[model samples]
Target chain A: MAKNKRDGTFYINPYLGGVLLGLVLFGTYYITGRGLGASGAVKSSVVSAVHTIAPVHAEGNKYYSKFLSDDASPMSNWLVFEVIGVIVGGFLSGTLYGRLKFIVEHSPKITGRTRLIAALAGGILFGVGSQFARGCTSGAALSGMAVLSASGIITMMAIFGSAYLFSWIFKKLWI
Target chain B: MVGPLIPMGVIPETWNNVIALLLGVGFGFSLEASGFSSSRKIMGTFFGYDFVVLRVFFTAAITAMTGIFYFDYMGWMDASMLYINPYYVMSAIIGGIIMGFGFALGGFCPGTSFTGVAIGKIDAMFFSGGLFIGVFIFSELYPLFQGLYNSHNLGGAKIYELLGMRDTVFAFLLIVVAVGMFYGAAFVEKKVTKVEY
Candidate 1:
């Protein structure tokens, strides 16, 4: 039904989708001994790019140095590969759902430019936050919750709690 | 192989990236198929228009947690061997707060943003680009935040242990909480005016 009736809300049942995602996560742990991640991939990319452009600076920095190692290129990391797969998978799904299109999704009240600026700002914040938390929603929050990690639960609460409060403050962004 | 095939040497290390790719496919498919490609849909969880994010997130967490428990109980795998991110008190909280702020502004987390980009959303591309800039800024300013970043490291601490409760008990409570939230979300969704995304 979700596939047939095509509109903006074209999607599978939320509960079913959740189960499928959970299974993938579970399989990831069973096979890899760790949870899925998103921000880590981006972090790695930043590190690798910086290292390539300004080798000495990347090495000198405490944070970038932490991720850089002698044995492998930062780009040759697990998260990087996983992220590439994520892109491929998403493309496949988009094609199947006939949802692939180049458009800016924005509130009717706001122009596309405003939406993009907000998105860029949001990305920057998320990027910084991911570094601080050592993960993002998927890595620290969801995956962490699955394993019952203390930091995971605390971080999860902080993210959702803060987001709930902030969403009210920025209600115009959505509604 | 008991589990965590790569780490346990049941599977060779070379297959690490290969496995990561395969699993990522599943992960991406799940998120996109669930409508995570739309930032509006994700924002709906907070605005109360659609509870898809809440429903899917809690359900997935519960399902995986339950699977881990059952597998460990049956001795099919060792849960302890699984890598848990070290619990850094100050940084984790601060990072989450900052990220939450971003979520409201950006309407997409890093994972979901990638899914958005996958579906050819121009906004998602900008968001992803911003992610790079943010990471660069943090890396450049790492010195100022170094003290806060490395401060309070509780390595791989489990929540149940910290709460001084049995694992099973804590897990049961979490499941109850998730189920309760699902009902609450459904109730809230009914009251809120639906927005066409």
Candidate 2:
């Protein structure tokens, strides 16, 4: 079987990758007056979809209504467009580096089904957490840290701290 | 002229979305290039085999923090206009802890998962589907969680203010800390038994 192009070997130096990521983040803040975000776009999409299908239900909800406005669809917001660019930019990078492929990435110890199940469950938890926190890792934690926000610092520490313990419990799943 | 472009009008409002797309391109390119698109590579941090997450995250944070301070000193941008994450102390920490567990299990955050999707990872696609479902769930249940979510508001508080330190001092300390962690990551990567993914 052919190996996954991105999985087989050679990754760029970590520090160089860091520098590049830093520059991107800095650029994001400089231009937008805000940092990069990912989960918010998904939240917006969900709100839009819910509103479309069940406007009454959406309007009745406290969470969905905060994002809704009479002048514009929540789905048409900046984060949504930025997320679209993320897909495009990521694809371009993969193509450029020969890293695009179809495969299920998992620990050798687990079946693809198990990995997928875990992935789904994890995503759900992340989704809920991000909504409550007002942002996900990229949006709340990382971006917040960039501006030295107190919330950002707290979130960053909590995430790494919690994940360290959780990762140990799930050791068999990864290593 | 010490920070945000849009609010300060250093850049016009019309360019916001356009610049957002361009900035996102840069953001996506960086994440993909850093191997964030791969679940195994991302999970490597938790396993002690790879520390890319720590490296990229801290470096980016410290770099941007320093740059913002520098720009403020130089009067290139208005730092005050930039958005800071509001400090809802309990909610932020609790939410982070939950997100952390999700990350350890799922191996992809929302942004990286999108990158994974771009590279045709069906698992990422599923993860994103789950994200939407989870968001919907949260929205529906917002009344139950609203109190916790909005609790203990600190109103865009800064770490420097909290610590009663000069902004530059805080920023410098962060750089030093990031550098130390980078070295630590290198050391650990060398010591750990190599896990081929």
Candidate 3:
């Protein structure tokens, strides 16, 4: 494995990583009958928070009410558990690779503060977009594509296409 | 035996969450090991410096799709029982555009960002906080976006059905297209000067 001089951690080959990911995804569908997701877990957390802080308000809202259930806590959802596992899994990988550290990763051209702001703003946009698209890159686009769903293909195209277009526009932030 | 064990009642419902946790571990480990925990590395696809995202994503998609098809053919699993995301023409495109903008700026998707958070990236934390706020805003103002959100509903439509092709045929073509893209990405990576993150 080739190590990065700065980080001292070696990254896996991309194609090999992809195959592993694909097998995981395949296994997920085989066992659970659904694809992997990330945004849904975040949505579940948001719903749980709102329900806790303002039950009346959460119940009053159509969108929030849809997720509010009497049987189980929103935080008790499968996606939530899955997200927790994601954190654990990520930590394990970091430990194995010696990539565990506290730092703001950014390009040299930009200040850490600038990078943080961009990350926040971008996350906000993704949050809003995931709702409209009904899923983010993983849930809607990738998972959807795996099943040959029209929604997944279209969303995937739109995401990559728009990102390619906007990357050129937001070139200063990155390159 | 029919597949989709949980949905088909082959796997007990009590084990659902446990399975979710195990699967998520795999999902997270794969993403992080692929260097998806880094925003700059993820952004490489857009910059022509690296095509890891393209390679991983397409490869995953095709591999899963192929697996499902094979399972269905062999009568090992019932593919029809699988869940499919509904198509809302306008919202999917519009939402995807917004996410694309976010990707350009933030450089990490929700899944990847969580992996970043695990590695102690402060920026990922803020980005996740922003996700909560964004979802809150969207919820609070759901009425304003309701019309567009519910406008076009094509319920669980398959790509092959829409294009008038058989699933096997479409899957084969997709594999071909994915292979082509992989080759193209390799070519592009060689031609472009590498940008060290």
Candidate 4:
């Protein structure tokens, strides 16, 4: 099992990685009755930040108030903790593969600035879209599909289908 | 005892966050180890240069679905107890289309962006920041989008039921389709010229 290639970096085979990921997702459902998530944590952080900066305003808002509680901080949620674990796990993997470098990855044709701007724009769109759809790729799509949920399957197709269509429009950014 | 330990009370509520942390670690490790930390690598799926995203994604979906079926069949878990995102016809499709546009432009999704941040990718940091701003925007403008967001709710509908098929039958067909796509992806990858980031 060649761990490292000649370039001082290594990656697991995709299929094997998929199996491991599948088992992890299965464990999540077995134990927590919920699927994995990433954007939810960011939503939590946003709620917490708003609560801290404007307690009254946050409490008054419809969305923020839905997550607010008298006994617990908004940040003290399961998704937040899971995201922290994601960071730790990612760091560990990076260390193992010798890829823990501070660099901006982009296509050679695009400037780092261009990539950053696009990334930011994309993130904003994803954040808004996730809220509307009730979950992102991990939460609504992957998790939903695991249980054969209609919304999950539909959302998954929409995301992939739209991406395939838009990728051509944004071809200059990648290829 | 039926599985989904938390709901079944097999695992106490206090351990929920702890379990979450452990599961997240596995999720994160698998993603980063499979080159998901690189946005370009992920975008490869869209361009047909690399099919890793499709391969890993479909494989994991099938594996988890299969596990759920097996567990339920063996009486180890109650499939009915699992949480399902409710179906909102318009919102789901509209939101997904927007996300797809974002994905191509940003080259990273929420989960993958976190992996990028962990590996110290500056673009990922900006992308995460963008997420916070986007959420804030949505929260502030909730009233304007409230109707669209709340309309056409189907309430946790299952795909098999919607299609008037058995769960086992649906699962079997999904697996067959996934395997066929896997082969097709391999063929496409061979034809497309590899693009290095």
Candidate 5:
């Protein structure tokens, strides 16, 4: 493996990384009959939290009730387990690359508070959109693209297209 | 002999979780190694300073699509059984636009944020924390959005079918487009000013 000038900055080629990701995605479908997902786990977590706080409320809500069942906990969902794997996988990558370090990352022009605020707002929009679209960027856009799903392609275009437009609007936040 | 191992029974249900873990590992590794752990690098796709996201994303999409199609042709997997995402046009477009807003503002999406969190990025942690809150909000307000959410349900619709073309033809065209974008990205990368994270 080639090393970068800075420690823990080494990375594989983008094309190679893409091929590897493709295989992982292919493997996922082959074994689980599904593609990869990240946000769905977060949704599960949210559902579980609501269920714990107000079982009645959770059951009353059509969306929450749909996911709620006596046979298994919401936390025991496939996406939940997969997310756990993501954490472990990410940890392993960080450990191997020696990149594990606790810190806040932001543009030089912005304060940590500003970044955090943006992050929170972004999460909220993403959360709402994922529900509306039936998945997040990973679950909807990427996975959808793999299977040539119209929703996936449209969602992918919308997200990236909107981001490109908004990025210019919020250029100060990043650049 | 193509697609969706579950319907064909080529892959047992029992091993699903284990496979998830292994795939997750690869997913994480590729993401982190591609510098996705850094917010600036990811944001660079919009700035034109770096096209890593564009390069990696389209490459992965085309690669997987082609691989699956090829395997189907080789009599390896049953493509007919493969699961395609259901199309809900209005919901998809609206949801995507909203999610894009989040991407530009949040500097991290669910998947990349996990990679960042793995590297001990506090911002990533907060972004994920926000996801929990956001999802909670959605679930709580489900009644208000239920109509839109379930408004349109096209079951596992394929893009090619909708476009009035064969799947192979669409896939082939996509490959050409992706290759063109790859070259375009390289050219843009060279022209844009480099931003240090």
Candidate 6:
């Protein structure tokens, strides 16, 4: 029988999973003197693509220019490398768990088209939001909370608080 | 040698990217193994039918925090050297709200979305593509939001300092709160109707 993702017991114990994730985070700090990040890779990719397409335009932009440097390519970002590894690791887990099928996951109430549109909208907002907060949930919230940073704590509160309220509003999206 | 061995020159600088890749492997494996690759599983936290996200997230936070604290106390690592995200009060709050909005709609964060893509979820691919476009839009419109983005900067502020609590005291309280949430989450999960994805 295929293991259902929703079953609380199908996956690794939450506490154990947390410890593994926490250890990875702790290791990240110990080794890199930094936390893990996700959205940053997207930032780097955007900068690199822009820089490649229009050097002058990219350099002229205040936001993109901040990442421009003569000595290094924005594509050589640490987060980019880490994200590649994330793909490999996720693949490994999916293989082990038999979740390697190509599919669109959605609530029965919604069509796949609806899920796609919502996913796209959500991703865009997250991209825009992470730039403002200077980090995403992983970088600012989880990583920050590990160090007990004021901004991280505040961002965590705001993200969860807002999401909790909105989830209710978007009740049909999930169930 | 200090714990942040790379900066301390205990580890060669050339290995930086290599280590990043390694750390990411562990990070991804943990998230996926924990069922984070599934959007429905993650959305469960908000729905009250499942508290896995809360359990995993808080447990991870406290676990790492505890490790850092103990390591710092032991003089095994220089916690002060760790990169603290700057507190841009207004921006952090506003940005977090926006990200939260995205979270509810998409059912995935940037990190989790990647894992979903790795597992071949089509919706995750759309989400990831949208991230690129969204970032591009933000960069193009940077001039308009620059003021709001950079406003109210507090440099590397710690939560304990902001809250007027000792570091140890705050850490202890966080642990207590996380544990309480775990229990409360279980209570809520039991009460709510389960939804099959």
Query: Model 3, A144: alpha-carbon shift in Å?
Result: 0.4
Better of 3 and 4 by DockQ: 3
Ranking by lDDT: 1, 6, 3, 4, 2, 5
Residue-level lDDT tens digits of model 4 in A1-175: 3444424257788999989889999988988887888888888889889999999999999888987763284224888889988888888888888788789888888899999999999999999988888889998899999999999999999999999999899998888
CA lDDT scores, all candidates in order = 0.91, 0.84, 0.88, 0.88, 0.82, 0.90
Residues B1-197, candidate 1: write the lDDT tens digits: 59877778898888888999999999999999998989989999998988899989989999999999999999988999999999999999999999999999999999989988998999999999999999999999999999999999999999998999999999999999999999999999999999977
Top candidate when judged by TM-score against the true structure: 1
Lowest lDDT 10-residue stretch of candidate 4 chain B: B11-20
Q: Give me the displacement of residue B44 in model 6, in angstroms.
A: 0.7
**Tens digit of per-residue lDDT, candidate 5, span B16-101:** 66766777888888888777888888999999997888888888888888878887788887767666778887888989998999
Indicate the docking level reached by candidate 3: high
Give candidate 2's whole-model lDDT: 0.84
lDDT of 5 at B183: 96
What would the per-residue lDDT of candidate 2 be over residues B55-136, giving only the tens digit for each residue?
Answer: 8888788888777777877888777888888899889999999998988888899999998899888788878877887888
Local accuracy of candidate 3 as per-residue lDDT tens digits, B41-143: 9889998998999999998899899899999989999999888999998999999999999889899899999999998989888888888888888888999
Chain B TM-score, candidates in order: 0.98, 0.95, 0.98, 0.98, 0.95, 0.98
lDDT tens digits, residues A58-137, model 3? 99998888788632742249888888888888888887787889999898888999999999999999999999998999
Write the number of the candidate with greater TM-score, choosing between 3 and 5.
3
Show where candidate 2 strays beyond 4 Å.
Answer: A1-8, A70-76, B1-3
Q: Which interface RMSD does candidate 1 score?
A: 0.9
Worst 10 residues of 1 chain A by lDDT: A67-76
Stretches of model 6 off by over 4 angstroms after superposition: A1-9, A70-76
- Cα lDDT of candidate 5 equals 0.82
What fraction of native interface contacts is shared by candidate 4? 0.83
Clashing residue pairs, backbone N/CA/C < 3 A, model 4? none
Number of the top-ranking candidate, with DockQ as the measure: 1
| lDDT minimum window of 10 residues, candidate 5 chain B | B1-10
